[model samples]
Target: MVQNLSTLQLLLIVGGGIAYTVGIPVLVKRRPDPWPKTFGYHEIWHVITVVAATMHFTAVSDVLA
Candidate 1:
């Protein structure tokens, strides 16, 4: 219904925002070579958490309503 659609929209917005925030900085500017590579590990962890949170949020939201 409307609520499910809203949840999905919210998820997409939030996820895309996060990806943009993390991706732009790494790609646009360059300071050190190993720095971006090293930092990418942290970014990957963030991505995994975001995905997990999205899945968990959707499941819980569906169950609640």
Candidate 2:
């Protein structure tokens, strides 16, 4: 499916991306540490989503292009 991006869509993407990135680290239980020092698969995915969202927003902001 071809999807067109909107301001709300971008905002949601950014919010979701940040939530995932921060949530995983905060939610995961680690011994001697509240946050995960070495993130697992889910955290890795979160990082990827955050990076993708950042790039997406940057692209969207360049409205003249």
- How do all models score by TM-score? 0.42, 0.40
Q: How accurate is candidate 2 locally (lDDT)?
A: 0.56
Number of the top-ranking candidate, with lDDT as the measure = 1
Instruction: List, residue by residue over 6-63, the lDDT tens digit for candidate 2.
Output: 6665665666566556655543642233245676545665655666666566655653
The residue ranges of model 1 lying beyond 4 angstroms of the native Cα positions read 1-39
Lowest lDDT block of 10, candidate 1: 25-34
The regions of model 2 sitting more than 4 angstroms off are 1-38
Alpha carbon lDDT at 25, candidate 2: 51
For candidate 2, the per-residue lDDT at 56 reads 61
**With candidate 2 superimposed using the best TM-score fit, by how many Å does residue 30's alpha carbon deviate from the native?**
18
Clashes of each: 0, 0
